[model samples]
Target: MADKQNVVSVSDRIPALKEQRKKRANRRLIFYLSIFFILIGIVVYFQSPLSHVQQIQVEGNYTGETREIIDQSALVSGESIWSQSLGSAKERVEQIPYIEEATIERSPDNITHYCPRTDRTAYLHNNDQFIPVYGNGKLMEEQSLDTYPSDAPIIFNWQNEELLEAFFVELDKLGSGMINHISEIHPSDDDPTLLRLFMNDGIEVETTIENFASYMAPYPTVARQISEPSDGILHMKMSPYFEAFNPEEYAGRFMKSTLIRVMVG
Candidate 1:
């Protein structure tokens, strides 16, 4: 009787043991599936195309050769986005004189990136034609009227090349419209301290190197004061004012009238 009862108990426990083995197998499968998904995510993150830059686009460039400028600017090309830093790229590009500013961006897929470059256009009237001067003073010799960008204001002579360059930079600061209306700039190498300016609207401006912007700060209001663009010397040396000179009295119409005007006035 004892042997028969022991056999019955062993048979009853067989189904329970099988059920526990199935539960253990299911847990092992779930663990393997979780590890597989994590590996797939890491591969996708590291392998995407946004990893480096594939193309570079340059704009607002005149007189500068694109490939040469890019090389000089030290901008990297045909590399993964993940390898390049935007701040480092910007600093490198700014080293080029023609590029006033640069902006870099990466594509969403990490495969490609682009750089948009801006060039500051400064017009220098030389030999009867208006020539564009880059920030570094390089002359744009390309003679394409149709292909040329919009007209920039002609840089009239100030004191010297240095002073005139400085004046062109400070031009935007002054609200004076004369920069747009000016036709010619004649610098006196004799007294470079005095910048004699000629306007297209038939006027003369005599300003010095020190306070060009300050003198011209009130020029818009002062323009209303003049009936016509006075042909005489508008002296800014002593005070920001104008003096009409007789072309008949002076051999050359423009003169260093600072001493003459102060003595006469």
Candidate 2:
């Protein structure tokens, strides 16, 4: 009786072991098949248009400059968004000296966003030809425009790069009110460091580069005090004072030339 019970127990254990092995085999097979299907799906997803960049957007741009910046970034439509080296592309965009900064972002919908912060442009006037000078003091010599910008000040004889760069920095400090009123800027013949600024309202300003912005800040106030359209040169080197332009020389030039007073600076 004992031998018969033992044989029955052995038979039951062998069938249970075989069932567990079968279940393990089925799980492994399912896992491999799932991995294969996932790989296939990944390949299809990459090959389809969904993975490619369909649109590109540029923000905070003026003129055709942003377009050129985007082109330099090497970001284009139909390119794989996943494959693009965004950090490198951004570095390339910022390579332009005039561009202060560049931001690049990729959207989940396969869109590329690029924003390049370019410096405001000022004109270096040369008679009929006007060259663009960026706020960073980069003078674009190759490019020239015939028309003069009424809103911007025209810089004259700014040959020295260092001084011109410093002058541009001073220009950055001026507000639109003062900047728009300024028609021309030139270095003094006797003292090159001393600047002569011609205002559109007909007032001439004489000051050094050190006091440019601060001296020009009170222009509107000082201009209102004078009765004539143009009176004399406003000397702001040490302090604000007026030197009357000999009215007899330039007619319709200075409004208060009636008094030929010799005021020594």
Best TM-score among the predictions, by candidate number: 2
**True-structure RMSD for candidate 1:** 7.1
* Cα lDDT tens digits for candidate 2, 1-265: 9999999999989989999999999999999999999999999989888888887777766656766777878877887778888898889977665676777888854545455454554688876788877666666665678987765778887667777778777877775567778888888655667788888888787777876788778778777766775456777555576777665664432233545433332
Cα lDDT, all candidates: 0.57, 0.73
Provide backbone clash counts, one per model.
15, 0
Displacement of residue 96 (Cα, Å) in model 1 is 4.4
Model 2 C-alpha RMSD vs. true structure (Å) is: 4.8
After superposing candidate 1 on the true structure, give the runs of residues whose Cα lies further than 4 Å from its correct spot: 1-35, 41-80, 83-92, 96-98, 110-121, 125-150, 155-165, 175-178, 236-238, 256-265
Worst 10 residues of 1 by lDDT: 256-265
Each model's TM-score, in the order given?
Answer: 0.58, 0.76
User: What is the Cα-based lDDT of residue 204 in candidate 2?
Assistant: 80
| lDDT string, candidate 1, 41-160, tens digits | 867866865444566655555544567555654546556556667677667766655556766655643322133433334466555566665544445555323332344545444335
TM-score of 2: 0.76
